[model samples]
Target: MATVTKPEGTIATTRKAEAEGDQLVTMRGIDWQGYLTILDMKTDRRFPRVVFLDGEVSFMSPSPTHEFLNDRLRSFLRAVLSGLGIPFLPLGSTTFRREERRGGVEGGQTYYLVNRGHVRDKKRIDLSVDPPPDLAVEIVVTHPADDTLEVYRRLRVPEVWVCTETELVFLVLDRNGHYARTDSSVALPGISAAEIHSWITRGGYDDEGAWDHDLRRWIAEVLSPRLRETTR
Candidate 1:
């Protein structure tokens, strides 16, 4: 299992499958350059995001339901960050690859919290030079062949949120450099995965405006004081 330490690049595991929509194709023995070519050709940037791992490649197309849930979750997180005065840089569906790890992943939504200050003025992210996003999100309307969490773990992302229609799971990277299921986020304190799941499930927002209003209000009236007292 060769892991990319600096994003140099491809792998050799192969699996194939077909579907009515959002097709998935996995194969091994693909060099880093081959994977790069495949990625370069896709201009539309539609569904079926790609993942590359040690000698294997996976192409996945997410469904509309997946997109809807992904959008809602992304918005919810940004609102929370803004309301709480937590600086963050949202990296939406950015393709991240590292040749050294022999794996790469494009998160449904990714964010740089600890490194937000560094990327504030940048026009784009250069993973070779910069740390990977602290948090990556996945909405599992359809499952992929390669393990998503494993890919992130190779990328060294601090946190991952895996959301199914029924449940949301948080995986935090431990000191030993592996993911462990946790109730609360290590990357974003004062918020738990269950709480987020509940809010999305409740779904009272008439529109984005309403969602923002309510989220900010909740933070200001409820979470703020709690966080302040805890810090004191």
Candidate 2:
């Protein structure tokens, strides 16, 4: 049973399963942010061991904060995605459930990689999947690594937003595997990144009720009038 604190950014875990080797999936413990999974690039998705969170034990689940934040972001994104005619799954913590999603599964567990087989740089990450997410959101709280932005770039998540207690910064993954801020949201059209960032940093960060209501209201206001009709 081995565990490590959540890293702010992506940290290479020492453990890497051999090619075509059998991976022993075990659940030892759970971290607040979530856990990771290490998958064999070859075959047998079930065998790629899942570390952190219930550690070899599948009964237990993530903590309250993890569950709540996951739900909140997913719920919001699900709505926005639909409005923009984008297809996506919540895949918050469950993103680690799949073998290919277990890039950093062993040692550094809080953050999980999107796709495993197509890895470009060991130190610099460039994650890719057959069907990549249009966007991803991470509620950045407290963690070790000072550079959390690297994960989004490495994962090649297309567009990402990191919501801290203070602000929400949006980054768009480009052709060169770097991120840049944009006025319009690639995933959520009509959703202003600057306004959302400002709202997240305000005094209402702690109160979920107030924060959500305000966010929804803002979304409704900015979206096409036809959407408001359906939302109502």
Candidate 3:
């Protein structure tokens, strides 16, 4: 979630054991761990990824796995994005973990606290109380989405998306809580954010469905066209 999430010029303070600075502010808010147990759902494999404010939860599953793969494909993406100028944050956790998980950790449904989310309306709501992850992308290995999607609605996020490794995608939460079959990225243009995501799927690779620079090329090329079209 912290792919340098904060803009460079925002804050220069640091959090450390024996370090002190003018911007140093101890977290005095919600019981993060206590609220970890909130993601409750009926799934044979229910893994609750606790949503937290620190970079800790993001460094783990869902976020971690996505980060790891993003890292794996970054080199290819960086060149393409740089050439095409596609800017974006890798994205972070969800709200359902806080309201549903109930401390049960499994299924890789990890959650990271977002900094801002859309509780209602187009306004960006920031709960200065709990750490908030702007958005959380959950991967469903296998399961239905009725209740799972509802969890996002309750949290009031501007957007929520779930990708099934490859096949189905649910972008159920819009800025105002409008669910839809097709979804676009807050950073990229297009009705379907498929170009970039292709790199995350099996199609993102060499002949054997393995990931390689080849898939990266396809992403760069495809994104280049999309960006040019949208930027124009």
* Deviation in Å, model 3, residue 9 alpha carbon: 52
**Candidate 3 residue-wise lDDT, 1-232, digit = tens:** 1122332344423332232211112222223332232223213222233333322221122334444443433443344545555443333222334424321112222223233232323233234344333444545443334444554455544445565545435354555666665656542235364545565554434443346556556656775676568768
**Which candidate has the top score in TM-score?**
1
Provide the global lDDT of candidate 2 against the true structure: 0.44
* lDDT of candidate 2 over 1-232, digit per residue (tens): 3344344544323332232222222333333334432232315432222333322222112334434544565556655555555544443332322224332321111222333333323333323424344455655443312223453344445777765555556668878888877766666655566555555444636667777677667566666565556667
Per-model C-alpha lDDT, please? 0.77, 0.44, 0.40
- For all predictions, the C-alpha RMSD in Å is 5.0, 12.4, 14.9
- How do the predictions measure up, each by TM-score? 0.83, 0.47, 0.45
Regions more than 4 Å wrong, model 1: 1-23, 144-146, 204-209
- State the weakest 10-residue window (summed lDDT) of model 3: 19-28
Candidate 1 C-alpha lDDT tens digits along 1-232: 3332223343345565665434567766666777777677777785568887765668787777777788778878887788778888887998887888877877889998988887777776676788888899988865752377888888888888888889888889999999888977876787777788877666756687787677778878988888889899
